[model samples]
Target: MKNVTRRSALGMVVAAGGATFLAACGAQPQATSGNASESASGSASASASVSKSVRSDYSGVAVLEGYTSKPSDYQPATRTEPSKNAPVPVKPAVANENSVEGLYQSIAFFGAAMEYYMRTGKTEPLRESALDNSELKSILEPEKGTLGDGMQQGKIWMQDPSVTITMLSAQPERDGDAYNWDIRLTTDTGEFIASKDRVEEASSDDDRKTEVERTLHGVYENGAWKLTGMRTSSSSSSSASASASDS
Candidate 1:
C-alpha cells in the first residue's frame, strides 16, 4: 500500500538503464522528420552502441499539454499509485519558452510506466495510461519478452522509496514534424525496494544515490512529445567512487 513518487521511481529506471534491455543498434543521426527507423550501420561510432547503451527514459515521458492548442487550458493532475493495466493521469501545465514544464510531466509519466512495466512486465498499458506517439510506440514494441522474462525469473520489483531532483532544465528544438529536447536533471537515490512476490519477508534497501547529467532527445508527434534517445553526461555515486578507488 506504500505510495511511490516520480522522483523515487525515476532512479529505479535509471539504474536499469545500463542493462541493455533495448536494441543492439547504436544511435544514428535522427531525421528532422519522417522515417526514424535506423539501420545498425547508422549507429554512432564515437560512443557505445546505441542499443547497448542505457539511455535515461526520463526526457521522453509525454506531457499531455503539448497536445492542446491553448497552453493555458492544461490543468494539474494528481499523483496516484500506479495500477496494472491502468494509465497514469498527467495534470497539464504550460511550460516555459524552453518547455521545462512539459519535460517534467513527461518524466513523471515515464516513471509511472516504468513502475507498471516493472510490476506487470508489460508496456501495453502505456498506450492508454499515457500520451503516445510513433517514437514511443517504436521504443515499446521490441521489449516484450525481455521485460516479461525478468519479472518471471527474478520476481524482484523496484519502488522508489525516497528521492529528490535539483537543478532541472529542458531545452527544446524543432525537427521536421517532431520536437527534440535536451533535458538535464540530478537526483538523490533514496532507499528503493527489491521485493520478491512469493515471499512475505520484509524487504531490504539498496542505495542508488548518484549525480547524473544527460542529454535527452525526443520527437513530437500525435499531439504529444515522445522520447527518442538520450546520452548521459556523467553518472557517479559517492559510495561507488570510493569503492572504485579502493579497488
Candidate 2:
C-alpha cells in the first residue's frame, strides 16, 4: 500500500495509498447514470442515490453519500475528530440492514475505515466491524495502522479523497450463514507532500486509470452486515488505463 495524506476543506485530514490519486482513493462506484467521475459537482462529493454534499452529523464524520440527509436526521457520532490529525471514529454497525444493503455498506465501511486510518492512526472502526477477527482484518489492519502512525507523527495528509463502487452484487453461501459479494471500484485520490504541502495526485503514467475487482465474504449479524474475508478476483492495470481516464 502507498502512503499519503490530504486535508479536506472542513479541516479534516484524509489519506490515500500509492503514487497517484487512484491508489489513494481505492475504488470508483458506477453511477446509475452519467459518468461517475464527471457527475460529482462539488468538493469531496460523490455520485450515488444518496447525496455526497457535506452535512453536519453528530458523529463528526461526514455523512455517507448514499444516505439521505435531512434536518431531522440525528444519530450518535460514529467518530471523533479531536484535531486534524486524529482518526475519525465511525459507528460500529449499521442499522436495519438487509442482505444486499448490509453487504454494500460493509464494503463502504472498509474504505471509510481506511480513510480514517490514513488521516489518523485509528483502527477502532475496523476492529468494531465484522472484519475484526476475519482474514481481511489480519491483512489490512496492521497496514492501516502503520500508515496512520506516519500521518499522526509525520503530519502528512491526503486531499480530495474519494471512493466509488461501480458495481456490487451478492449471493448466499451454501451454509446459509453468509453471502459472497463482488465489487468493481475506481478511486480518485492524491496526497499532500513536502514541507510546502505540495499536492500530488496518485498517478501512474498520467492519462490512465486503474480499476480493481475483488470479492468479499460477509455475514449479516446483529442488524448489520459484517465483512469476514476478501479475495482479489482480477485487476486492470495500464491496459485499461486509457479507457479509465477517458471516463
Candidate 3:
C-alpha cells in the first residue's frame, strides 16, 4: 500500500471526500456514481433519514454510504459535521461468502469505514470491520494511530477529503500463497479543518492530480478472506511515494 499518512491528504481524498459537499468549500467531485461513491445530502445534519444516518451498532460489516454537506453549514463539532454524512461501515453477510465479490465488498467497505473512522473519531467502525494481521497492522499503524488519535481529540478533521477506491478485477491473481487484485485509488486532499478554527488544504494550492495503483493482497484464513497487504505499483502524491515493491 502507498504510505497512508496524514501528510498526504490526496492519498485519502476518496476516503476524505466520497462525500456529500458544497462545491465551494472544496473541489467538485468528478467521480462516477456507484455503490462505491453513492452519497446523500446533509447526511450529517438533522435532515438525513434515520435508517441512513444512524451510528454503527458494532455488529455487521457493511459499506459506509456518504452524505453531502455545504461549506456554510460546516461546524466545529461532530454533531453536524459533514463526516457524519458517512454512515457507519458494515460488511456484507459473510456467510458462505467465498467469492471475488465478497472480497470486493470487504475492501470497499473497509476503506469507506476507515475514511469515516479517520474523519469522525469513531473506533468501532473500523474495529468490527477490519481483520488484523501483523505486517499490515504495522504498516498501517501510523495512519490508524495518527488519524484515529487526531479525530478522537477533535484536533483535525478532513473537510472534503475525496477518496475513490476501485476494484480492477472480477477475479484474483494468485502469487504463491497470496491472492492479489489490482486496484486503483484516487484522492483529493480537501481542506483540513481543526476544531479551534484552524484550516489548511494540501491540494488546494495546485491543480495537478495523481492516480495511485496498488495491489490488494489477501489470504483465505480459517474459512474467510482477510486483507493482508497493499503494495504500491504507482504513487502520485509525495507523501505516498515509496518503493514499488514495498507494501
TM-scores vs. true structure, each candidate: 0.39, 0.47, 0.56
12-129, model 1: which lDDT tens digit per residue? 3343331112211110000011111221121222222222212244333333332221133222211222212223233232211113344444544444444334433455434532
Best by TM-score: 3
- What TM-score, to 2 decimals, does candidate 3 have? 0.56
Off by over 4 Å in 1: 1-104, 118-122, 125-148, 152-154, 159-167, 170-180, 184-206, 231-247
lDDT agreement with native, every candidate: 0.32, 0.35, 0.41
The better-scoring model by TM-score among 2 and 3 is 3
Q: Over the full model, what C-alpha lDDT does candidate 1 score relative to the true structure?
A: 0.32
What C-alpha root-mean-square deviation, in Å, does candidate 3 show against the real structure? 12.9
Candidate 2, residue 109: the lDDT equals 54
What are the per-residue Cα lDDT tens digits for candidate 3 across 1-247?
2223333334333222211111111111111123322222232222422123123232232233332322343332332243544444444443113444445555665566545554555555445433344423322333323433345554556555444566665456777766687666554445444434444434444432335656667654444456644433254443342212212
Which rank order by lDDT, best down to worst? 3, 2, 1
Q: Is 1 or 2 the stronger prediction by lDDT? A: 2
